[model samples]
Target chain A: MTKITFKDAAGAARTVEAQDGSTVMETAIRNAVPGIEAECGGACACATCHVYVDDAWTEIVGKPSQMEEDMLDFAFEVRPSSRLSCQIKVAPNLDGLVVTTPAKQG
Target chain B: MTESIETDVAIIGAGPAGLFAVFELGLLDIKCHLIDILGKPGGQCSELYPEKPIYDIPGFPEVSAQGLVENLIKQIQPFNPVFHMGEMVERVESLGDAEHPKFRVTTDAGTEVTARCVLIAAGGGSFMPKKPPIPGIDAYEGRSVFYAVRKVEQFRGRRVTIVGGGDSALDWVLNLHPVAERITLIHRRDAFRAAPHSVNAMRELVAAGAMDFILGQVSGLKGEGGQLSALTLRKESGESVDIACDDMLPFFGLTMKLGPIADWGLNLHENLIPADTEKFETSTPGIFAIGDIITYPGKLKLILSGFHEGALAAQKIHRYVYPDKRLVFQYTTSSTSLQKKLGVG
Candidate 1:
């Protein structure tokens, strides 16, 4: 199992153990983490699961795909670090991934 | 006033479950009129991700969302179900009593449908435009700010600012350019998700200095009493710029909301209608619900589960539509009457 941490806008962090092949959004939803709506259920269709990867973990998590970037246009307050958590896969390499959920998702 | 449509069953929503319900009700010789807020059929399947593939649909190993919707529409074509598209249901009045229940469903577009029974197959409710998180933006809504361009005359001789990089933004920018005194297109990044042709047209206009293209996000709105004066935009460099405009249109796509359905007086559990597993009927007699908008003991939000619920609900609805006629369970493969209804006999 890979360990991942999710932090809310207020800096409250919750770390959970995510199984390999699952996504960060799935882990967040499995753990009942607040602020991650995942309205499209990880199809990367809706941008409600928008998250800001920590600056240190940006290189490790990698950039979003072209399709995800198109969908990100629907999100609010997007930044260089903004990525839809549904597109980020959970792996042993990303065991210590840290991401912050935005205050409001469009 | 136009004449109201009379049918045996009035099914709300044109999604997968609702479309399948028409087939189920049609097999029982029940005519139906489908009402949906979207202009076309396939609610979320067509609206959200039409090109995306779905795996869980029965029989089909894998099918695109639009592909499944097309098959469902074709499967129910023999029923000749009438469609009232692009209208939101405003009110549902129970006209008849418990023994012989009837409902008069009204839409915002002034369309009325009276039926022996009403079925709610609305998956996750209606889709509405997603609003940005700008503080105090609600005050300017329907006044200085608009989600949809109802009238092109409203932007005449006005300074308009269109936000977002999608088709809605670019299309409106090019459309309203002739009427508006000035058009400003604002987006967070340089890349656009709109059609390449529209993007090129916008860039050509920008090159000609006909309009302004700014790279930023709307951070705040400056206005008073539902009138917009200017909007504050934050750039990627952490710089803020205030652009003076009388009207602002932000196209951030759509989100599902349980709109108007909550006020219908049905017993709701966490915004979902509570229905029985057997008939899938709501607390209000003759009014049934299925699909994601309903909750039962083992309710799964899958399309197959909705198909099952709809099939069972049709059994009960058949009794209400033809109270004098006796119902005989028959399979389409073995029953000539069922095959005749399918137009395959």
Candidate 2:
């Protein structure tokens, strides 16, 4: 299992344990994390699961794909560090992953 | 007070599969009541892509999604299926033991439906729009801010500000431009992901001074009691512009959720309900699943496939509804009794 931390819009940090290979969005929804709406259910079709990867873990999470970039344009407050949490798969190496949820979902 | 309804079968979802289930159950002298979260039938075919053409339907070479839904409604008309629209099935509990089980299905509307069997045809579950992130935007909802245009008349003579770059936003800008007293469209960039023709039309409108297109983002709202008087926009240059608009329509597109079905105790496989290939029954006895919600080894998510599953489910449902009677195959065209039920005899 991988441990992930989600900082919600209110700046409250909540840590959750998830199985390796599960997407961050899936873990958030399963644990009832407040910020990630995940309306598309990880289809990557909706950007409601938008999150900003913490700068410390930016290198670990990698970059968003071209399709994800296009979808992010529809997201609210698009930032250089923004990513759709659905595209970030949890892995053993990403055990200390920390991401902050956007104040508003686009 | 919660309303109580008793039926032979409670079909959850009014999509093609659920509507078709009514016909199949009706042929066997069984009555059915359907519940749907959407106000109307057809599921994604109607809700997502109603005008899109579907070439894979068995009969016609090509038919619009809405046309297929209309045809399904007409085909099932003889059965006179009862429908409870605009309600979400919240919880499904088995009332009896395994051998002679009954289901007590409840909707979010506080309505309880007790049935001998339950069939779930929820196509990809519920359709929920991706909400835009504007701080305190919820305060203006249902007053000056709207996600869906339930009726065009609501925007008459109102100053409307549309946000987004997708088809819904552009289409509404074009549609509401005529009747709306003033229109302002806000996007982070000038580029749009909609059709080229729509983009060109929007540009034409901007050129004609019929509508204002701004390259900015909605940063603030001035409103009270769910009513908006003005919208504050932030441009790329860090300048704030306040536009007077009483209405804000934001369409971020929709995503499907499994919704309340996930809470039910049925066995789930990868976010989908696991159903037996024989009768499409879920892990729980007397509860069946069909359409996009069900999963099997080689199951295909298609309208025709769901139709076939509904037919097989009806066959199994007969045994549950009438334990003493043996099911006999009868052709609808030849059997007077079946034809009479179809109102065709």
Candidate 3:
């Protein structure tokens, strides 16, 4: 199991334990963390699952794919660390994976 | 890696146009597979206003959206189209050449579909439910709170507090009244945005003391582990009502945007795919678009227009899929081959 912390737009932190193969967005939706609308339900089509990986964990979470970047173009307040949570699959080593949701999803 | 399904044509939307396209294509011996975001095939007709009457459809003077979808489903029954319901087509890429182009379509659920051609009949994009902004409301989702009624038996003997002024909320209140131990409906105001028939029925139920109706907003939730024990409703008069309920259903309705379709590299005009009226093919050759998703000169986003487009698109698709074979246009009413395909012979 991989433990991850999702800091919502309001700065309220929600931590949840997810299986190794589950995406961070899946963990947020499973835990009912706000700010991650996930309207397309992790299709990477709707950028509602937009998230900004914590600076410390940016390298660990890696970068968004070209398709994810295209989807993120519609997201609000996209940052250099911004990534679609659905694209970030949870792994065991990333126990402290921390990401912040945008104030509003696109 | 994901499982893949291969087909002659992969229609994107399961709406009227897409469903009709199946019949049109199937008549020409082209098999199709469909994918829709909603759990069912009816699209907005069934999702938004299943009971609302639509008059513009040909032949039928007036028919409800759901009724039309049902009839279309029956019309295409002989086609035996496969539907990937509750899945959104996320990625679409072109393979092969322009003369014999094929598509690799993938949904959010990791379902891959390879097709000789693609039809974007995604009427007005995916229908996304509007969620209420009750603080910590997400905590109760999937367990105590729901936007769509996936099952009615889940609320059996449970206290259900439905929140909304629309038809969906009022409709559920009436439907679940008999099964639920207690039903409390809370809206921002006494006025409702639902149909008068539904509104009158709900008012009758409240007047008969069968259920409780309150004019208020859901202030917050009181629960743990996604299970709610009660809800805090703030009335217009600045009074709070601690409604004791096990489940809270919010039917705020839905808003449609060109979600995900924007990423497929198709040239979009005002969020609609620009297609030629003759073939309904978009800028991407072999990637045909119909229904409300396409925009052309003098184009009408009506079911009738989509039906016409689907017929024309099928003709063009036949030539694309079988370039060496000569194409012949035949009316279904007069053609024996078409009747045999429908099993009506």
Query: Evaluated with DockQ, which candidate comes out highest?
Result: 1
* lDDT of each residue in A26-79, candidate 2, tens digit only: 999999999888754566666889999999988878999877876876688876
Give the CA lDDT, 0 to 100, for residue A43 in model 1: 83
The lDDT per prediction is: 0.94, 0.87, 0.85
Q: How well does candidate 3 match the true structure in TM-score terms?
A: 0.58
Model 2 TM-score is 0.61
lDDT of 3 by residue, A36-67 (tens): 88765565656688888999998877887866
Residue B176's lDDT within candidate 2 is: 95
Could you list the CA RMSD of all candidates, in the order they appear?
A: 1.1, 8.8, 17.0
Task: Report how far off residue B268 is in candidate 1 (Å).
Answer: 0.8
Cα shift from native, residue B218, model 2 (Å): 4.4
Cα lDDT tens digits for candidate 2, B62-178: 999899999989988887888998888999998976778798999888889999999999988877666676779888888899988878988999999999888889899999998
- Weakest lDDT window of 10 consecutive positions for candidate 2 chain B: B126-135
Order the candidates by DockQ, highest first — what do you get?
1, 2, 3
What i-RMS does each candidate reach, in Å? 0.9, 4.0, 11.4
- Which ranking of candidates, highest lDDT first? 1, 2, 3
- Note the clash tally of each candidate: 0, 0, 0
DockQ of 3: 0.02
For model 3, residues B1-345, the per-residue Cα lDDT tens digits are 487999999999999999999999999999999999988998878765677788888889999989999999999999999999988888999997779989999998899999999999999898777666667978888899998887899999999999876678888988999899989998755666578999999999999998999877777799888999999877777788788989998875565768899998899998999999899888888899999888988988788899999999999999888888887888888999989999996
DockQ for every model comes to 0.86, 0.19, 0.02
